[model samples]
Target: MTDTSERPRADLRRAPERYLSRPEEGIETRHAFSFSGHYDPKNTHFGALLACNEETLAAGAGFDEHRHRDTEILTWVVEGALAHRDSDGHAGVVRPGMVQHLSAGSGVSHTERNIGGAEGPVRFVQMWLQPDAFDAEPAYGLRRVDPAQGGLTLLASGMARDEDGEALRLRRSDAALWLVRAGAWQPLPELPSAPFRYAHLTAGSVGYRTVPGPQGGGRSMAPGDSVRITGAAFADPVAGEDGAELLLWEMHSPVSYG
Candidate 1:
């Protein structure tokens, strides 16, 4: 028995204003939790997730080759395109409706560029998660999920066959990710619905509540805002007000209790 006690509850309409916003000349980012210069020891992680960063890059702007180790990095492109180059000899372009997953098992270096000139800016949401396994190998994969796949598309899964042949595999076996575009109300996929779950609004506004109760009041979530579900629950997205988009992660935490 460890780290247990509080009865499962839920938090909703959690504004993004409390998050750390890092802005630069060409890049502007709003971090969902403590990161870079922002530090909040108590708010370090949610489930198996660590960081959720909303990044916007000006045309011809980008991130230089940076290093990462023992992290499962997943990126969802919201607009325009991103040029990616990594140490594993994988180079490609990721656009809207596409997902870019990079698994830095032992270590890896990569770069991301908007490639779009001053005419267009690129927007994307990137999430970092702790892998279940460590120091395995560096790998990378990409997939473009269309609405045809379903309202909820499996972007990345650590569990084998969790994606039905259309998802990217993560080196870590503790997490699964889903992305939803605005349209018909959709049910959550079958995953470990833990006491805590993370829901991020990538674009537009959405209607969400808890699995059994009205946690969010079935209210709306503005773009850039997110919620933390404290009970075993899944949300049904009923509508997408102005091109809505969502990213949901379901996983078991390394820390457990009796």
Candidate 2:
């Protein structure tokens, strides 16, 4: 059972405020949270989630090797293919419907590029989460999920309470990631009740409302929009005419920078 002692709060985050970055000619990134050179102390993080970035790269464009440590990085491809290579000897081409997970436990360096000789551009949404413990060995994982499988799919989980082996594992035992692809005007699956929940619309549009009361009113969400819910349960969202693809994070704990 969820604790409802505190009043439920729902906050909508429009996509227009996402910090835009064009570090290179063919690479463009829109960050939902404060990122490099874009600092917003009040919007730093929600729960264990540190960064949510939507990136697009032109063919033959890529990011050079970069270092990361003690961060759980998850990437979901929306269009085209992305080539990934890391110092851990892991290499793969991630495409739509695939989830790529990189646990930079202690430290690791990697490079990401838009696969050449294929599509026009590669677009993906990447999220970063704070791990429960730090300084472990680095790891990597990849899983393919079928959007048409029906209902919400558990793409990854680190929650101790979850025993689903199908989900790609995470390093934090208090966080989980879910994905859903809904048809036009289809009702979405019930959202998991958690102390902190963050929902991002990756494709199409959706209409959502808070449960019990109308704190947020019946609102429509466009692609790239996100909502942060604290101590609240929301009514299931319904897809718009073009259908919708959504990613949700269920976080039981807040960020601990220990």
Candidate 3:
């Protein structure tokens, strides 16, 4: 594994604190929201990982007609429904318990909207991955997984595997994303020892006990909270509340990229 000093620091939160004072971005038509920014490349302590802030869109809100190039955009809807329309002419509604993926290889135009119809709020997590190679071709996909699906379900990966099955095939990188829901913990399978792990909580709470390095120690995470654990084993959850959900990513080491 690469030196732990090269990785980001780890801290636990029962729930991510809301910084209401930040400026909001209009990401779609008649829609605007704040980003819990871990987005900048320089701010990322390891590999090509970048995470956005938690977003809560008011009813009838969303971004429209934006363009992206050479990045892998992944979204996890925490609550309510998110409507996605893309240049690929793909449009759909993603509700709780679903993951939306867009590989903006060369470039792609897209928009995201909160379809709550002015009834309630919509919350979710959006992340960007720096691809090993850029400007290939754009692609889109999603996986609707139930919390009872337990263990790991591949949302997007560089290779094919049959464990929990694969959803979207990504560009050139050995990175793989796994989604875990409530009930029964599963140990992370053998992976390159130097990889970096990013864990994002979408709902309820999960306890990570005695993981390696900074990720070690008991930490409780609720929705909107995220932790970056470099080269650590996916520890079995010692305990959980009713609606726990997690998104885990195994990425190439910083040493490899450096």
All models, RMSD in angstroms: 3.6, 2.9, 5.2
Stretches of candidate 1 exceeding 4 Å from the true structure: 1-5, 13-15, 18-20, 116-118, 148-150, 161-164, 182-192, 210-218, 233-237, 240-243, 254-258
Candidate numbers, best TM-score first, in rank order:
2, 1, 3
lDDT of each: 0.73, 0.87, 0.62
- Ten contiguous residues with the weakest lDDT in model 1: 1-10
Q: Write the per-residue lDDT of candidate 1 for residues 1-258, one digit (tens) a residue.
A: 122326554455455565646455788887777887789877677777778888889887889899999899999888888899999899988888888888898999999989646468998889998887789789988887865454567778887657456778976566688776654343433434655567887777767565555553466678777876666543554555365677878675643223
So what's the TM-score on candidate 1? 0.85
Please identify model 3 stretches exceeding 4 Å from their true place. Answer: 1-42, 116-118, 146-150, 160-165, 184-194, 210-216, 233-236, 255-258
Please give the clash total of every predicted structure, in order: 0, 0, 8
Is candidate 1 or 2 superior in lDDT?
A: 2
Best-matching candidate per lDDT: 2
Model 1 / residue 242 / CA error / Å: 3.6
lDDT (tens digit, per residue) of candidate 2 on 32-107:
9889898988788898899999999998899999999999999999999999999999999999999999999999
Sorting all predicted structures by lDDT, with the top scorer first, yields 2, 1, 3
Per-residue accuracy of model 3 over 161-203 as CA lDDT, tens digit each: 4334546666635677777655433333332333566777766
CA displacement after TM-score superposition, residue 82 of candidate 2 (Å): 0.5
Better of 1 and 2 by TM-score: 2
In model 2, residue pairs whose N, Cα or C atoms come closer than 3 Å (at least 3 residues apart or on different chains), thus clashing, are none
Q: Pick the candidate with the highest TM-score.
A: 2
